[model samples]
Target: MVLANIQQGEKESLRSYTNRFFAAAAEMEDVNPTVAIPNYRRGLISGDLSKSLQLVKPKSFPELMARASQFMLLEDTGNGAPDV
Candidate 1:
């Protein structure tokens, strides 16, 4: 799937990559969370968000998004690396 190939740019911020990822996801029909979640995790650049997702897998797309949103906020506030 094309989405599977989506990757965060070298210098892209988490929020920017998340937005781009969703935009690509929205274009597809009946996206399987099983496939989408893995793709999302694989695409993330090495960081707190990526590490969190790897250690504690999200059961659903919403859960993944929630975690991503939290990490993105932390990144925006200059706390990209969470205590996790």
Candidate 2:
């Protein structure tokens, strides 16, 4: 399954990966949470989002996306902060 095999590129932003992921998912007839959940989690880079997902697994796809969205927001904001 293309969706199952999708991996976050080394330099890809969380936003970009999410867009790509959804695009692949859109082509599928139906996405099973059992597959989507693990695939999505597995595809994330080993960072805050990945760590969070590992620590507290999302029970559903919606829940997984919500957490990813939160981390994406944090990542975006963190990138804009001025380093002391």
Candidate 3:
């Protein structure tokens, strides 16, 4: 199976970009969670979402997902995004 190169699109929301990254990561045959977690973080657009995830310092893929979920929820509630 060929894996698509994942990237954050211009004007794409954090949640959408993360979802795409997660989907691509899931398709890989034998990805190490420890390594993949940092790659996932690197793939995020540079902003609050990315910084916040870095702060959490997730050690595994699942931990990253949990943190991303919380960040998305906070974004939904209008509390996570930085003011322009």
**Winner by TM-score between candidate 2 and candidate 1:** 1
lDDT of each: 0.88, 0.80, 0.72
1-84 per-residue lDDT for model 3 (tens digits): 222356677777768978788777777879877767777777677877688766768887777777788777777787855431
Question: Local error of candidate 2 at 9, Å?
Answer: 0.8
> Could you give candidate 1's per-residue lDDT for residues 1-84 as a string of tens digits?
488898999999899999989889999999998989999999988878888989999989889988998998888898656665
Candidate 2, residues 3-84: lDDT per residue as tens digits? 8789999999898998789788878988887778788878988877777777788888788788878877877887531221
**How large is the C-alpha RMSD of every model relative to the true structure?**
1.5, 4.4, 3.9
**C-alpha positional error of residue 28 in candidate 1 after TM-score superposition, expressed in Å:** 0.3
Where model 3 places Cα greater than 4 Å from the true spot, the runs are 1-5, 81-84
Ranking by TM-score: 1, 2, 3
* TM-score for each model: 0.91, 0.84, 0.76
| Model 2 stretches astray by more than 4 angstroms | 79-84
Model 1, residue 15: what's the lDDT?
Answer: 93
